[model samples]
Target: MATIREIRRRIRSIQSTAKITRAMEMIAASKMRRAQERDIASRPYADLMRQVLAGLAAQRQGDDDIHPLLVQRPVNRIILIHITPDRGLCGGLNANVNRMAVSFVLEQSVPVTIVAVGRKGRDFMVRYGREVRAEFTHLGDRPSVVDILPIARVVTDDYSAGLADGVYLCYAEFVTTMTQRPVIWRLLPVEPATIEARLEVGYIYEPSAASVLAELLPRFVEMQLYHAILESIASEQSARMVAMRAATDNANELIEDLT
Candidate 1:
């Protein structure tokens, strides 16, 4: 058993840690509000893009005119767009994502290139000396589309150029203030079911169907990357907030027990 003085000393250390965590929690909470707002605002555009793609796909199905984005090819080289936090103290958010990535790599028998976004992913990849093709960071406080555009372009270009057979994104999808689930989402060969689901609602396409699809396809892919970045950042903050809150609460409980 530890003495009261020892307990007090431990408590003091925990208090200091709690202070940092609390600050991080406050910061994460503030950013979460902005992120959630941006996500909500972008929903309409995503919906619209999906609808337009579905309509175009339907129109072209009769002619057997398929876009390059809709074709499935022989699997060989794959690229993973990994999203993690720039900073630490966010619990196992990064670790969980990395675990899923490891599983992804294990399940498939092909060469993989990683486009690691954020410090956590980059740092983790460096240890294994894996092929991390690109890295983006310093965007956690407030990530913008422009911040992620280069990486998105590279991945899309690789797929289009046949450098990579498929592209997948690993991210933590934001559920609520306290819950985030790691997920792997397909980025290339856009899922037909997604288009079909969106097409259930009627939408009028501007210009010709082929023309609209030609434009929307690329943008849709870019937006998927952008949206994943936003979701991951938001999820990071929420996880930090919840983790810090738990630490703070535990500290208070210890103090109560001591008194």
Candidate 2:
């Protein structure tokens, strides 16, 4: 048995909550659009860069002078660069990505260390008792290459120095407004796709193919990391927008029922 005054107060509280969620939905929508645009825009460049690296790798497939980054070695230890959102409220995006990483770590025979890129991933890894090599956070919605350079450096340096024999990157990839796929990509021992002889065009390198590849390998890693972050950001915003919209709808439904 509820009085009119109590019902009115509860309704007011729910309405206020609805207003907040509606505002969040709008904000997330705006961020989602921008994030999607940036993610899409970077794909072309990333693909082109991958093509060029593949061409270079194809040219020096069996050469002993191949870039260090392209050198494959026995698996000793594994490093996973796990990327997730800093905050929650994004449906199951964070959980999905974290679960994927956990599964990956469990499946691996070698000892796995994490390079956590966001607060959520870092906290999850720490709680799970995983050895976190490095933690990077506070990368806003619009992070540039400069912001991601340090992370790239850690992965590249560790791999080059033989600190880790294998490296992987895990992130939530933006597929659609309603879908975010958690994907794990091998980042070390750069496996470039072989190009057909007929498909390869003859182009002169600035100094030598080896020199160009040596310089390009690091840049390629940096670009891949930056692009992955962009995808994760887009996924985060999209999930948040959807989740907030749902929350607002639920609040409105509750308001109607109470009235």
Quick one: best TM-score, which candidate?
2
**RMSD in angstroms, all models?**
2.9, 1.7
Candidate 1 residue lDDT tens string, 11-37? 788778778767877988998888888
Q: What are the per-model numbers of colliding residue pairs? A: 0, 0
Candidate 1 local Cα displacement, residue 106, angstroms: 1.5
User: Once superposed on the true structure, which residue ranges of model 1 sit more than 4 Å away at CA?
Assistant: 1-17, 62-65, 197-207, 257-259
Candidate 2 lDDT trough over 10 residues, lowest sum: 193-202
TM-score of each: 0.87, 0.95
Across 133-248, the per-residue lDDT of candidate 2 in tens digits comes to 99999999999889999999998999989999989999999898999999998988788763223335677898988888898889888988988998899899999999999999
lDDT scores in order: 0.83, 0.90
Q: How close is candidate 1 to the true structure, as a TM-score?
A: 0.87
